[model samples]
Target: MKLLIIEDEKDLSDSIRQYLALEQYTCEVAYEFESALDKICLNEYACIILDITLPNGSGLEILKELKRQGKEDGVLIVSARNSPDDKIVGLNLGADDYLSKPFHLPELGARVAAIIRRKSFSGQNQIVIDHLTLDIRDKTLKNNEEAVPLTRKEYELLLYFVSNKNRVVTKEAIVTHLWGDDVDMADNYDFIYSHIKNLRRKLAEAGCPEYIKAVYGMGYKFSIPS
Candidate 1:
């Protein structure tokens, strides 16, 4: 999953990114308001960790923009403001959860996971699609009763596909989702093609039907065979 951390504190943002990266999440950061707004408008994330106070804007305004745009990305407010009113207002503005600052990273992680589960997967830890079962917490996949070994990137790619199943996802989108800002270092999308090829071969060897389809010039789609 991808996460956006809208925080002015560089140390905190780096810590959050490192911790979440261990959980196999692609993390991006916006240190101020305008960049945060631009990122929110341009891309979608599984969850956003937002601080109520920002460099030039209120995180509440970001919440308002999300609601105004009808974007359903899960949001978790992580701020030093622990007052009941702040919590109430954030929730009312469509935040999925709120975590007061000076919190344990584990708790924040759990809260983020919970919000993503509720918003994206209907609060389910295991997503069952046809013959495949994805254990979200363990980051494992099973084909029927057998376990399918997957690299971290492969698992993330598969989860991405499953989350946007049946929708055409462009290679650019895939690159961004997988590599985030670091994608600028790449010259081509051959890495994406390699990952997709490996994922297809792994799934097929695990006795799964072809779920990923090339859409020619468009991109790729993950749809079960009818």
Candidate 2:
């Protein structure tokens, strides 16, 4: 999963990033309001950790803009302010959850995981999609009762496809999600094609049906046959 931390407190943001990175999540930061807004406009994240206070502006404006733009990224508001009015306003504005300052990092990570689970995996840890079973916590994939060995890229690719099943996902989006904010540093799209091909081959060998569909001029979709 990819998370954007919109926090002005450099120390707190750094700690959150370091902690979450160990859990296999790509973390990005925007310490100020404008940078936060720019990141929101540019990329899609599994979750956004937003702070109510910013040096230049209020973070509630960021929530409003996300709602106005109709982006459905799960938001977890974290701030030093403990005002009930702020919590009420943020929740009313569509923030998924809120945490006060000096919160435990483990608890924060759990909240982020829960939000991602609801948004991406239908509120379930083990994703049972037709013939495949993926345990999000264990990061394991099984075809029927047999284990399927997949490279890290291939596994992430499968998760991406399954999460957005039936929706066309562009190659560019895939690169961004898998490689995080430094996608511009990626050389080419060949790696994506290679990962997809390898994932498909492994699934086929494991006796799973082909669920990925190419969209001709568009991108690719993961959908069970109707």
Candidate 3:
């Protein structure tokens, strides 16, 4: 999933970004309020890790703006302020969860997964599509009760496709979603093609139907035939 981390502590933000990246999440960091606002206004994220105390403004203001825009992005407040009032205000302002400072990265990751599950997958740990089943927690994919091994990139690609089923996702969008800000430095999108091809081949070999379709020069779309 794609995540926006709005934090002022550079070390903390870098740690969170690195840990989440290892967990196969595309994470973007903004250390100040304006940068965070700019990102929130421009991109679509599955979840946001917001800090209440930002360098320029309160993260709560950003939350309010998001709510005003009718955005349903999942938000988790990660702040050093552990007061009851702060927690109440954040929750009332549309934050999905709160984690205090000095928290374990694993716990934070778990909270992110839980919020995503509730918001996008109806709180289910397993996502089933036709004969294919994916265990979100364990990061496993199976077809008709048989395990299908997938590379890390392949698994991320499949998850991204499933989450955005039927949408006309562009090559640029896919690259941004998969690599986040790093896509800007990539030489080309040839790696994306290779990952998609490998994923399709594995799924097809596992007896799954071809669900990923190239949109010519645009990108790809994932959907079951009607």
**Among these predicted structures, which one has the highest lDDT?**
1
Estimate the overall C-alpha local distance difference test score of candidate 1.
0.93
**Candidate 1 lDDT tens digits, 89-120:** 99999999989989999999999999988887
Of the candidates numbered 2 and 3, which has the greater lDDT value? 3
lDDT tens digits, residue span 1-226, model 2? 6789999999999999999988878788999999999999998899999999998998999999999999999999998999999999999998999999989999999999999999888899998877889988777899887889987777778888988888999988888888887777878888888889998899889887878878888889998765
Model 1, residue 92: distance off in Å is 0.9
Worst 10 residues of 3 by lDDT: 217-226
By TM-score, the better pick of 1 and 3 is 1
**Which rank order by TM-score, best down to worst?**
1, 2, 3
How well does candidate 1 score on lDDT at residue 66? 98
Better of 1 and 2 by TM-score: 1
The list of candidate 2 runs beyond 4 A from truth reads none
TM-score, cand. 2 vs. native: 0.94
Between which residue pairs do clashes occur in model 2?
none
Q: In candidate 1, residue 62 scores what lDDT?
A: 100
* Best first by lDDT, ranked: 1, 3, 2
Residue pairs of candidate 1 with colliding backbone atoms: none
Question: What's the true lDDT of residue 193 in model 2?
Answer: 86
